[model samples]
Target: MAYKTEHITQQIRAAREAKNMSQRELSARSGLTQSHISQIERGTMEPGLSSLVDVARALDLEIVLAPKKLMPAIGNILGSASVTSDTLTSEQRKLVGRLERWLAGVRDQFSIASEADTLKDSLALLRHLPLSADELDRLREATLHLNRWQDDPPSRKELSEFAHAVRQLRNATVHRDRDGAVPRSAYALEEEDDDA
Candidate 1:
């Protein structure tokens, strides 16, 4: 089958547009030259794997593969059909405000982690996952039985462990098929599936 470079480039351009970012902004975020990013979005250049990864990271996106039949459902969930920020209920708005403030604080914490020269940024980011209240409660309950469970306020190491656990949960729950392997960049799944 022919590779649809146009489709690939179009999706990248659309993603950047949806985020309201210009090619120059994306280039800054992804550490690629603006000309390269422009070439990429214009379909004049096919990005290398590393370039694609950098761009995806800048967009806070993960490239997951699913069965063709499930694409519609996946697309629906990823679509912005949920209530907009402007329409949020008062309580919902408060929660969102709190979360946004917390994120700002966490960004500082991540910077501090960097200043300290530790791998704490990853932990800080994972701790800020926008889990629902129910999920938060469930995670808290599960924390009691964790092998590294600490006191009411977990230490940096304990927090790191918790973040690792959350990452584990995310990996297990997302991007899995019936047989549990998700490939990357195969336009179509093969009759005999392959793991990427």
Candidate 2:
């Protein structure tokens, strides 16, 4: 939690370089001067929390504080653990983690999840789902339209169709996951072997 400014600077520099962005571009996007950005990257300037936040936002990175033991490392750090011995299988746990991360990436903290948000979120969520090329393209086109219509609300029919398509995608995803899941009999056989 108490990282040296040098470590922070290294992370910032790495993120910028990984994106192949110049310091000037980072400065422009983050609203910091190029000299200041360079100084931060060189570890000559210590950035405040807010400035680091701006840089992080510009680079699409987040700074998370977790306990060293890392219990919060699993699932949502602030939310209830979705994994339980009696409920979620390991596969289900993994899928849930992926979905949560996708949703988190779709929206910043404290943002509302509108219908448009849901469609955008589905694009990332469907990576884990078994979707045909046409289905994927349809979702992508719909999401693009929703994103473009932020200034102008989409038509009633368009919204209805997009929502229905998202529902269909989600239903297909659940069924695909279910079909791919190991049958309970497989677990029962394993239990019997353990007893034997």
Segments in model 2 whose C-alpha atoms lie over 4 Å from true places:
1-3, 71-196
lDDT by residue (1-196, candidate 2, tens digit) is: 3347778789789879978999999999999999999988877777998999999999987777754433312222112222224333444434445434443443443223465466555544444444444445555554565346666755556565655576666545433323334212212223335321
Among the numbered candidates, top lDDT falls to: 2
Show the colliding residue pairs in model 2: none
TM-score of 2: 0.38
Candidate 1's C-alpha lDDT? 0.53
Error of 1 at 53 (Å): 1.9
Q: What lDDT score is found at residue 180 in candidate 1?
A: 29
lDDT of 2 at 36: 91
**Total clashing pairs for each candidate:** 0, 0
